[model samples]
Target: MAAQKNAGDKDTEEKKKEKVLRRPPEEEIIIRGGKGASIRRKEIGPESEVPSGTGKVAGGNAPANGEALAVHKEVAVKVDHLSMKFNLSQEKLDSLKEWFIKFLKRDIKYDEFWALKDINFTLYKGERLGILGLNGAGKSTLLKAIAGVYKPTEGSVYRKGVLAPLLELGAGFDMQYTARENIYLYGAVLGYSKEFIDSKFDEIIKFSELQKFIDVPLKNYSSGMKTRLGFAICTAVDPDILILDEVLSVGDAKFRKKSEKKITSMFSSDVTVLFVSHSLAQVRRICDKAMILDHGKLLAYGDVEEIADRYEEMTEK
Candidate 1:
């Protein structure tokens, strides 16, 4: 009887351990979306530790070590010690049985891919920050993290107001639905109300220039047409913060100019902008401040012209 009880206790303990191991991590809280969404509040904590050799800027614009950053201006966005990590499997198992066997045997290995590491920055209201990086430097990953599409592995991003993310335009559209149907569906996905969408419905259709084909299924619409519609819906209302990821050239040259004009018109307001563009000249034109990322780490951040010059040097190398 004593031996049986001990065995049962051991089994129960093992089951408890398994349950603990199988439990998922905490769900990441996504902030508000779309135009006029209220910002969520997070308790501000001490500044996060910066990685070694970071926080340097050209022209001596950055605050010195141990020097308090002068921040009298209202902050629009703050990214604190932000890090994004992914566990890439070392080997590909053919089936679920094989994967389970490997998992039970503790034979599965993973490669830790740090997409963004120890990134820190702050943007004031009405400032445009251009993000510059080579391919795979984690520019898009950083933007996604800020947009709350991907939860950070460490740290946090705080924003003051509504955010309109123009990343992966038309990503949420239903291919089987008509353009008219998708306008309402996609609008709700962005946190807009039916009443709000109803008011902007015609404007969105007019801007997309899909009047004749509004009743046609989205599956039949060309990729460019879908992109134009997505752009029109997202930009229908002015947002407090706008995140742009390689979306300047959405459709034909004419539509592209129209879209660019719409974005530029927002700058005259007090909205904060985070822009990522491969064109150095475009970044210089659209941003007053800039930052560069190399190998998932912040390399340089400061005045736009200096960073553009540095980016040119990096490209030449």
Candidate 2:
């Protein structure tokens, strides 16, 4: 009986040792400042007792730990009441005698042309807003205003974040310079640091598929080739806000498809896109909302389908 009791005592001791060995060490989680308060922890099993120095498990109402990531933050771009106008003057300078005669007559003619009149819109992050209109509908002008290239004549334009504009195929490119040199120059003109351009150089070249001709001067490049390079460079540095003005039409069919895919990928990120296109079908496919402009005036702005239907109705009338 004593031998059996001794064996039972040994078994009890082993059970106590196993319980001690299975216990986890006390865990302390420290959250650094910068992001808002609230650190989350996973729940422990009910059978296990939490030790001192360990934080309490977060409740179900608490946000997930992934919510603290930077990508979860929201951003927006606002463009308020932007308008532009150009003044044209008609003045004739004649011979010395005629100039004196005209001075005596004191005649002058001036005309005011409004390019964009009281344009207003806001683009929240991750939104793809399409601007559609006819040839002289001020679509390009509105894009330039938003890009800060053209100051408004009457109203104000306010953008909340960084803006990347692809207004022209090669707006700042120097024909005399090599493609590599032009890349730096254009990047600088677009407000990118030299360091950024250097880092993105290889990616830009790869995307353009022009590594073979990157050493050649831009003047020697075909229009389509130049367009490809320009598009690649413009898109390499993802900006908070992106403006595109009829630039997608510059390349061939295949390149255009590639550009479209690139743009789609960008939209998937936190980028806000303001796109101007003459292709109504393409606009319908890519845009959740659309604005219709006619002769420097906003005819309609709302849901993509509703605006498109209204625009078609106006055109048919």
lDDT tens digits, residue span 1-317, model 1: 11112233455356445433222111112243323333344222222222223333232454433334434445667676778889988788869999999989999988999999988787767879999999999999999988888777877666655678899887789999999899888878886777778888899999989999999999998899999999998888677788999899567899988998889999998778999999888888888889999999999887788889989999999
**Where does the lowest 10-residue lDDT sum fall in candidate 1?**
21-30
For TM-score, the strongest prediction is 1
lDDT of 2 by residue, 1-317 (tens): 11112232455356445533222211111111122422222221121212221121112111233433323333244444556777765655546776678778885456788888776554545767789788889999888776666766765444434566787886568899999998888888776777778878999999999999989998999988888888998897766678888877778889989999998888876687888987788888888778888889876666677878877787788
TM agreement with the true structure for every prediction: 0.79, 0.71
TM-score of 2: 0.71
Query: Which regions in candidate 2 have their CA more than 4 angstroms from the true location?
Result: 1-75, 91-106
Q: What clash pairs does model 1 have?
A: none
Say what the RMSD of model 1 is.
Answer: 14.0
